[model samples]
Target: MSIQRELIETLQLNLIKHKVILLFGARQTGKTTLLKKLLTSDDDVLWLNGDESDVRLMLQNQTSAGLRAFIGAKKTVIIDEAQRIEDIGLTIKLIHDNYPEIKIIATGSSAFELKNKTNEPLTGRKLEFKLFQFSTKELVNHHGLLNENRLLQHRMIFGYYPDIVNNLGDETELLKNLADSYLFKDILMLDGIKKPEKLIKLLQALAFQVGSQVSYNEIGTLVGLDSKTIEKYVDLLEQSFVIFKLNSFSRNLRNELKFSRKIYFYDNGIRNAVINNFSPLAIRQDTGMLWENYLVSERMKRNHYDKNYCNSFFWRTKAQQEVDYLEEKNGKLFAYEFKWNSKKNAKITKTFTSNYPEAEINIITPENYLDFVL
Candidate 1:
């Protein structure tokens, strides 16, 4: 079954405007699938894979005429894994500069490479989009609202990756392979890390500490690396879309704990795979952590897809009062706490409420989370 992605309309609009569209995501998140869906018989499309030496060599030609000859009147050119092609940014700049009528679509799994290559050359000439693993809203679109409750547990455990959601095969093995193979492939291939095991250990430690403040020195000690190296690995992991960091939110409160950050995985299944834990929720001791991670990630997808511009943080103080999620938009503050049980309710701490009296606070339980996220 083909699940239509929301980015198609945006990509089509960009194509009509003759802008280069760059689609980025983690490996196997359906970037190529999205591009294929946008292609049709009526369009004159030239498809090139950066992994191919011939394609790389053809695009490496520095002259505008050389690029024009390679394109040869093709109305559109699509490059897959474009970051692998040497001098791709310059090549793309030449093509775009000379052929104003040509449309270009490029897809890459690694942002560190692509962004560095294209940022300067394609400045103001490109539209960038991120395609995440399936979102709760997308699932609702596919199966309707009736099945959301039934699938919530599965989404929390197995995650919303396209292939995993579509397949009925062993999800554990699939997630294990994803964690073992594709999760760090870009990091290992692009960054010259001598000990991959250290990275794995760092990820495992992070998996166990989700929703909690992380200290670089502490993680470094646990993973047998220096703090600087630990920070670099974490940054690479975030760039690869495996995880994200949320910084502490402080507004000049002396008790506020600043300079600390919390880490969350982009998908729950990857987090579980790193920790080797996939037991049922009833038997799981970290269910609250799972729920917090799941909601935060889903909300992130929602914010991105809806183009909601906001700054996200987690609020904490020296007295140990905290809020699970904090979002500031248009100079207004919105805070939320996630509770796994529908009956349980979380209240805004008096200190937080008093300090930011203008901020709005809400508890997001299972019964009301759909409206909050979708």
Candidate 2:
């Protein structure tokens, strides 16, 4: 199944020779695959892999004339794993500034490394985009809504990573491999991680606490690391795209919980694999956790692809009244509650409604989830 990515059309329309296009995504999320689909012809494209020692050597410390000689008549240049190249920002800036007729596209799996390298040199000179796992809308477009709704159970367990989606029936093995090492490769390679085992333990601890506010101090004590170190590792994990942090939403309320945050894995399969549990919904105790994670992850993808900009968070008060997910856009509050069972009655608490009278309240159940996510 060679389904097209939703970003292809936007990327195609945004391509320009003067400013570079930077694509960032986790490894195996199909950055290269999307490039293959977008670049259809190789006639005038100069493809270089930064992972190659020779390629890195050739691009090291080059001047405008040097680059011109190297690139010779190529109209398009793509450097994959670009964060591996030292001073890639300067190199890209040179190409963008010197060659007005050459189009430049670079890809990296680590946002921290890539953004650190390019933020200054490429400021105001590049347009950036992030590609994530297959979204529900994309899947439905490829097949149909009925087929996708039928596969929801499997999706929550197996996730939507390109390879996992393409290779059905092998999700456990694939997710296990991903969770074991590939997801942490970049984080582990960076400095400041003295004990790697503690990092894994911390990730597992976070995995178990999905859909709830996380305390760095508690996780630190449980994992045998200090809170500062735990926070650093969590930030690194988020930048690597394995997980994300959602802060508590608070405004115009005296009892609102402030400065609290929850962490969630970007893909449910990775979260389950981290804890080594693949039980079905009937026998599982974490079905609600999985449902919340799936809904939030899909909504994030939809927001990014659709260019719907909003500030997202989970809302809770010191008194424990809570909303599962919240979004603030155009100065209006939108609160959501996620329930896997259609029979369960879920709604925003009156405390929340009274405090924010103009807010839009919604409950997302399995029967009506398509209206929310799609």
Candidate 3:
């Protein structure tokens, strides 16, 4: 892979002026791969990892002078897995303040750990980039972006993780390994939840209910836990990048369906893996779930990497009128419905049209979506 152009270009754009660049994502999203690509030109780059004992010792020295000495006179210094080091926030702050010219890049797996340590101290001094798995656009550079038919079919089956794309082995086994080894490990270690079994159970239930209103009380009842604990565990999963929550889009008090949010997996492959459902495109029962997840993931990448900041939501009413995604940008709201078929079945509701007369409503199908998203 000749390095996704977006990350390379983003590194070049942010590295020169910013004192600290923080890169974070789920495990195996290729943080190390992207950082190493950025290191190609500089011979003076210093790399330190908290996984190493000596680096942890140097970080915890409590003296700014020792930390400065460790940073040395390199033009660029990278701390991989910065969350493993104690007082990493103040240590990076020391280098950033004293050596204004030196550039620093740090990588972490979880946002909760990384942001808690770095966000407050490095305010206005840092640029954050999230390295997600291969986007439809990134995949386009290599294999060319998928067409409507193939994209919809493959997305539900194989998902967008980097290793899964490159592995070319049994996808079923690959997803299983990812869920068992990577996703579960982070949850157990970070949240101190002893039962990996319960997490798997919760996720499996979620897999069946994608794009539908999720009832935490019902989920707790099914999984044999209280609703509050279910919410906490779901938050933990979201923070770890295991799943993403889409809140209901509500502007009018009359028709808005409050207190009901839809959840989608960050990676459909992991979702399938947890549920142990590797049925081929022709035989799958959850094709709708797959389609919804693929669209949301693609849109998310466009929003993040392309710097298209917009408020996104799903719209529905008490009477069950719905739109899959609602985007608000530039004082205009845009409603979109994702359908696998190009045949149009979208109907704009009178209440929605009356509420936001300025907003545009359009159906995004396999044919015309690339022009909008890519």
Candidate 4:
């Protein structure tokens, strides 16, 4: 069964909306596949792969006339893995300026590579979109809610990476390959990452610490690196889309834990692969952390697809009062706590509730998690 991706129409609508479309995602999130689905035999397109040295050589240091001659009469040009080609932003800018009739699409696995290269050159000339791993809504649409609900534990363990979703019975090996291969390809290509083992060590430490407040100093000590290097490594990992940070929300309370962050992997499979743990949830001790990570990450996909404009955080106080997730939109605060066990009694902390009295709060469990994510 081919699962219909949600970003296809959005990308289709925006293709001609701007002179250039920049599609960014982590490796194997299906950017290339999604764009292929958007093309038809009726459209004229020229595809280029930046991974090829010849393609990189041909596109570099091109003038307007050179770009024009190279592109000829192509209506649409797609450069897959575009970040490999140096000066690609200038090349696209030249094409956009000279051939206003042509539409250019560029797909890059790493955002830092593409965004840093294009930000200045393609400022107003481009529309940007991020493609993520298979989302919960897409999965629900594919197999129906009843079946999807049954797969919740499986989803939490294996995650929703497109390839993982499509290729069953081979998920563990595939995730390990993805983690070992594409997960850090872009980061390791840089000059600063001389000791690749340290990067691996850092990720292993992070995998074990998922859903907890991350301390650079402690992580640095555990990984045998300084805090500054750890910060830089963490920044690179975030840019690579392997992980994300949710900052602590603070406002009126003096006890709020400010300047602290909790990091979650973009996909639970990647986190599990990092730690080399694919143990089922039944025998696992980290189910709560897994549930929290899955919920928060899926919520991110939901908001992105829904075009939700809201700020999200994990709120906590110095005295241990906390909320698992918090979102603010249109001057209204919504708070939630995640409980894996539906029978447990849960409530908002008096400290958090007293300060943000206007904030809405609820507890989410296996019985009602679908409402929170889907």
Candidate 5:
């Protein structure tokens, strides 16, 4: 039931140098478990939960003595649910300024809260990492028994949640409950969101619209919310790691559908739950949606952990020609298309190639997608 996070190696190296590491991800993605595994060797590791009263009191007090009293001489401090404590940014700043030797690792589910509170204060002091549900690579390496085909098949059904993997009984119901209890609770309570039902409607709409161009007006009408509210909700969901928006990639801008963006759920398991339709893969209608979401999320996790700060998007044209994923990095473009079948005939657009002649194109099929994303 243990997954050896490769980020542990990166964390060990970062702690030897950096003052802080901010870990953020969706709920139940195993942020605490990863930190627990990392802090096992450090005898002085101090764990603080923002939900606890004593921990909140210590974090709110700005005095250097209070900070020192809480931190003590611990070489490493692990803060769980850091967003729960108000003014945690200043607290982290105080610790970073006063105790340069102390290495801090903080995790939170809400990036909007975490980043807004800490990004400016810990600008130069913090290294950020996004923990995601188990990736195919991690699952393969850790379990040592998942065949590629079987993994792909299971992924389309149960998804890659840590708890879902650990407790293999009725994963559909388990994931549905987790999504409701974790993601639903966190995202619905955001500021100024008076009605949480709209958020649920928006998520359901997005779940069905995977890999398709999304219209704000259409979404607003369908969800019974305004365009501005729809935009805000989408941003909140992205911040909370519930869904992702991928823009259309263009260079020359001719015949490119630049205004339209494609949306994908961060986890297929949750998407199914949101829609309340966990159909078996044998009779499922949205296999393409599952594949697209799984591939994009896996690549996102790999790039995030590897610290590859590349721009990612989808490519499509007026003629309905499209590429599933586009990665832009270091002045070059890489185009990718995801297909469940090993069909070699991907409708590459003339505009895409002409504008970015140096770009390379690859087809990601079930058999070889791991090398493309992982």
Candidate 6:
């Protein structure tokens, strides 16, 4: 069954106005599926896959006339894996500048390649959107709140990837294949990495350290690589959308842990796959970490879909006082503490409240997390 994506309407509206629309996400996140849904039978569409040698050659033509000749009279042009094509940014720029009548949609799984190629050339000519693993809102919208509540633990363990969400059998096997295949595809395909095993080792170290500050030096020691390599691999992981990093929040307090950052996986299933663990929450020692990661990732998806502008961070001081999530938006601070156990009391740090008396603090648990994320 196909679920409607939140970005479909926005994308349809953008197509009418923007010369080019770039949809970015990790592999197997249903970008192509969404694009197919957006296209109708009457629409004059030219679909091209950048992975095809001939398609890349046709699009790589630098001249506007060359691109125009290839596009012909197509009203809408869709390119899958656009980042794989050489000079794609310049090619898209040429198409938009010369053939303003043609609407373009480009999908890419690798931000490192696409952003570097597209940023400057298509600066004013493009609208960009990020598609994440299915969000809580999407699931609830399609399956109802009652079903969502029943499947919460399954989501936390197997994650909300489109394939895994739609399939009912062997979630652990599916996630393991996804982790080994698509999850590391971008990193393995990229150049300058002599030892790919180091990347896997780094990810394994990070999988265990979710919800906590990560030290590059410590990870390097665990992975048997140097700090510089660890940092590069971590950056690649973030760029590939396998994980995200949250820096500490500080307002110049000397005791604030400003330099450290926490790492969280984009999906819990991928995280568990990294460590080869899929035991139920009750039997797992890392349930708290899973809960924290799930809430943060869902919040991120909500913010993206809603187009909410905010800066996010984890707050902690040298004294070890902490808040799991901190969001700065509209000149105000909203702090959140994540609790898997509803019995736990939510408390703001004395240091945080004293320094920023205007900020608001709240607790996010399973009982009320939908309000915050959805």
In model 1, the runs with Cα more than 4 Å from the true position are none
Give one digit per residue, the lDDT tens place, for model 2 in 1-374: 98879999999988943578999988888888898888878888899998899999888899999999999988899999898899999998998898878999999878888899999999999999999989999999999999999999999988899889989888899888876667556567755767888988988999899999999999999999989999988988888888999999988588999899988888998888888998888899999999999999999999999999999999999889999999999998999999898787777899999988999999999989998888
Model 5 ranges with Cα > 4 A deviation: 145-148, 343-358
Count of clashes in candidate 6? 0
Give the range of the ten consecutive residues with the poorest summed lDDT in model 4. Answer: 183-192
The parts of candidate 2 lying over 4 Å away from their true place are: none
Q: What tens digits encode model 5's per-residue C-alpha lDDT throughout 197-228? A: 88888888999899899999999999899999
Over the stretch 1-374, how does candidate 4's per-residue lDDT look in tens digits? 57789999898788767569999888899887787789874348888999899999999999999888887777889999898899999999999988888889999877878888999999999888888999999989998999999989988999989889888899999999998788656568854787899999999999888878889999999999999999988887887788989999988567889899999999999999988889999999999999999999999999998899999999988887889999999999999999998888889888888888999988999999889888
Q: Tell me the TM-score of each prediction against the true structure.
A: 0.96, 0.97, 0.92, 0.97, 0.93, 0.96
| CA lDDT, every model vs. true structure | 0.88, 0.89, 0.80, 0.89, 0.83, 0.89
Pairs that collide, model 4: none
For candidate 6, what is the lDDT? Answer: 0.89
Write candidate 1's Cα lDDT for 1-374 as tens digits: 68888778888777788678889999889988888888884448899999799888888856998788888868889999899998788889888988988889888888888888899999999989999998898888888887977888888988988888888568888998888788656567866577888988999999999999999999999999999999988888888899999999998789999888999999999999989998989999999989999999999999999999999999999888999999999999999988888675568899999999999988998788898779
- Would you list the clashing residue pairs of candidate 5? none
Clashes of each: 0, 0, 1, 0, 0, 0
RMSD of 1: 1.5
Q: Which segments of model 6 are wrong by more than 4 Å?
A: none
Task: Tell how far residue 118 is off in model 5, in angstroms.
Answer: 1.2
Better of 2 and 3 by TM-score: 2
Q: After superposition, which runs of candidate 4 have C-alpha atoms over 4 Å from their true positions? A: none
